[model samples]
Target: MSYREERRADQVAERAQDREDMRLKLEAQLEAKKIAAEEKRKDSEAKAEQTRRDAEAKRRQEQADKRARQQEKERNKAARRAKYGKVTGWLNRNPVTAFVGFVMVCSIVPAVISQVGALADAGVFVLLAALLSAMLEGTAWALTFMGKKAEDEGRPAGKYRVATWVTAFLAAAVNYWHWSEALPNQTWVAVVFAASSLIAIYLWDMKTHGSHGKTTEERREEKARKQHLADRRKHHKDIAAEADRLLSALPFGSIDEEEAFATAWRIKMGAEPGLSAEVYANATNARVALGAAFELGEHVRPELVRAGMLATLYNPLPNRLSEGIPTLGPTLPIPALQRSSGAATALAGIGMYGSEAASGNARENASEKDGGSTGGNASGNSPRGRSDEELEALLPKALKVAAELVAEGNQISAAALAKRVGIRRDDARRLRDRVIAERKLKLVDGDDTELAG
Candidate 1:
């Protein structure tokens, strides 16, 4: 109990309290750091999710672009093949008119020279005008080749050629009647000039379409077909025009995204943007209303579906339109209700047949069986239906194709769907599972908990 011993004990007690205080401060600092780490982890996860979403969208855009290119190449091939199947051989698409132009251009010179000796003659002037009009018409039609609606550079050209010949014949007759003195020489010159004009037209046609040509009957048929196609284009164009007009009047003020989307739908569906009954009562109104009907469907899909406005199975359009034809690559999106029809056919290749295709046998068998014996037996379930290898094969093919398509902004089944392609069905699903792993697969059903692993 000496004073020095008591002082030492007090110092030790003070050191213990100081050490306790330091321990408590360190605990508080550690707890704060733990909370900050959790917050940082959450932020990183959210950023990663956003990056994944962006990548998915980019991939889908690329796929859609690729599909569009493929479709265009196919269309060009079909057009080129069809071009050779016309009547006027190389000039079938516009033969008659070209002939008429050549004829008029040649005959007009002789007719006019003969008439110069009788300038005031009414019949001469009338003949001259007729010849000029015919020549102009033919030339105009030929120039139309530069336009997007000219017939497939085939049989239509032939028919137009002959029309020019008739004009030339009329001009030649007039020339003969007016100047008989030098008639023989003038006639030969006119004939030679007409031939040269026709030859020029031939050279031009050859240059544009190459040597491939069509037969006579084919040309006539192609001409008739072109006329029909022209009619169809006019019909669709008129509908689109009306829709565009209605959408422009909307008052979305530009910033409100919902209203902006609504306006766009109005333009697409041919509805009045104001949501008025006038549009509802019209044919365009029905298209607009389908949007609502689509929302109420078994799947939460838009009734009026659209891809990136390019040609697809859902949007086939024409490389060129005639006066009335519905241009190819511009078909409306398949209706949702026709799922078993258009969607199945487009997605599953329900009716396509080819050796390279996996669905061909299944499609043929389904038909042979007079239809599926049960509803469960569909495109892939015929008696001699798709083999396991075929199904697995399709998965990879579909995933490759669909992923590419999705990158291009195309809508497709997020679920693993095996269907037809041309004449074949896909035969594998492993690739689909792989895509799912990359988070590329978007499940259509929100309630379904299972996802491809």
Candidate 2:
């Protein structure tokens, strides 16, 4: 074998290898084409399924819309029938009102159009004249409806009702003027034209506002309610300005009228609503006196309780000595009941019988005076019995207090002086007289009517 033979063998082997490679490449291309065809078939199937689902949803929607339309049509039909039945029922129930309304429409409409047309003949714009006529009649009806609505809501409807009649009368006057000018000397026809304008509204008013047989009780209650409101208005005139101010200041509907009036009364009068300051003061004093009497009755002996009860039938004791004044008498069983009936009677006797009774009975035993002489046990030390030296010691202080009270604008009464100076009322009276004489302070009441010095 030579080198040429070896080369020929190599070339043959290479050709075999090239043919095998070409076969593999062709098979790969065919397999790729097959895979692409399978994918394309799957995509087409998916698109067809999507189209079917869309068609099915469209069909269902169309059916649902058809059913909804049918239901709506039925509801509309039922509503129309119900409306017709309501109209028939109302016409049957209010036949007279229905007839009146019919007459109002029949009489007023033609007259308004004719009268307004006459204005058009006088060179006014026909459309504008028609609009003016409509406005006149419309205004009357609008006011009438508004008035009825106001009445229903319990508001004052008088102005609206009056306005309605005014508009109606104006319309009537317009018609009268037009018919008189247009139909000259046909006064009867002109009168008819004017009456047409008024009669319609009159009948309408009768239909809308006629009382439907109100019961006697209802009428009474209505009258009473009106009277009560009138009385409240009359009585609260003094506080009206303050109440109106509050009504404007506060949010609407937050406080009612009566509550605002009450608050205003309290703010202005410094007392309860509907009560004058004098009346309130008197009532408060009475209550205080009653409480004092009850407290005294509880602590005193049964006989003294009976006596206090009897004493209450006539004039009662004062309620308070002074504002913020301390009770300085010795503490009996009850510290509050410092003023006794004996002291009050003795003081009264002094005032009535003059200086002899005052000088003689000034220093009474405390327990015997308060408890009404219960023998030795009641003969204790005098609580309010001050000596001349003690009275002298209290005089300068009492005068200073009286000056201070006068400076503060308080009247110097004996009880007030006594409470301020911590002395008995009689001693307080003597000191008060001396202070008045020394200071030349004018007495507010012209005389010491409580207990003379």
- lDDT values, one for every candidate: 0.45, 0.65
* lDDT per residue (tens digit) for residues 112-157 in model 2: 8866876787788988999888889889989989998998899999
TM-score of 2: 0.33
Best candidate, TM-score-wise?
A: 2
Model 1 lDDT tens row, 1-453: 999999999999999999999999999899999999999999999999999999999999999999999999999998887876754465766775576566656644544444443333543476665555445435534553533134563335555445544544554444444444445557665455334434444444545556458988999999998886466446556544543455566554543433444555566665543343454345333332332232211121222232311223342355321111122111123232244322322322111111113333443443334223323333444545566566555555555565443333222322223332321222223333333333322322211122211
Instruction: Return the lDDT, model 1, position 44.
Output: 97
Location of the lowest summed lDDT over 10 successive residues in candidate 1: 347-356
Superposed on all Cα atoms, the candidates' RMSDs to the truth, in angstroms, are 40.4, 15.0
How accurate locally is residue 274 in candidate 1, as Cα lDDT from 0 to 100? 38
List the candidate 2 regions with Cα displacement exceeding 4 Å: 1-80, 216-453
